[model samples]
Target: MSDSPRTILVVEDDNIVRMLIVDVLEELEYTVLEAADAAEALAVLNNADQTIDLMMTDLGLPDMNGKDLANRAREIRPDIPVLFASGYADSVDVPEGMHNIGKPFSIDQLRDKVKGILGN
Candidate 1:
């Protein structure tokens, strides 16, 4: 593992939900970048300077769905891990190499999910 902390990009349309996720991730000692919508999230993904270890986006975004955003993100960063957050996590059909977590997840769930995806 690298010495620097792993960074995660969080994309959610709901302000409160996004804030809560960011706070929880930060508390878990991961560097977090936040976006309110798909456009913002794409902007971050397009920036070559940004070192994002993983992306956790809400399935229901104001502009685009999480799956679409993840597709575009994969185009930009081919190997980046994508984690989808949804109220209907059990029903979500994430493709291979992608993951999903239910809404209202406990902090421990989020931490474990991220660690599992990042392999740390």
Candidate 2:
């Protein structure tokens, strides 16, 4: 892999939640991009200059749902990894090859999940 830290695109409609996630990820030494909704997320995804290794999105987006956004993102970056965050995480049935984390996740849990997905 490249020596640069992995870049993560975080898509959460809630400004506070998005900021917290962005702060935590940045604290963990990863590059973070923020999007308040699916439309903004798509804008980032469509940007060829941006390097997004993984996407961490909330299932309850203001515009499109996380699954829809993930599908759209894949249309642009087919192999991009997706991590879904949901309040009902235990009941969420994420698609194969995708991952999910419960809302209000601890900092350790977030760190571990991202690390596991990114193979860190």
Q: Pick the candidate with the highest lDDT.
A: 2
Clashing pairs in 2: none
Instruction: For residues 33-114, write the lDDT of model 1, one tens digit per residue.
Output: 9999999999999999999999999999999999999999999999999999999999999988999999889989998999
**TM value for model 2:** 0.97
| lDDT, each prediction | 0.94, 0.94
Predicted structure 1: lDDT: 0.94
Residue 39 displacement (Å), model 1? 0.4
Clashes of each: 0, 0
Residue-level lDDT of model 2, residues 6-120, one tens digit each, is 9999999889999999999999999999999999999999999999999999999979999999989998999999999999999988887789999889999999999999998
Model 1 pairs in collision: none
Q: Estimate the lDDT of model 2.
A: 0.94
Which window of ten consecutive residues has the lowest lDDT sum in model 2? Answer: 89-98
TM-score of each: 0.97, 0.97
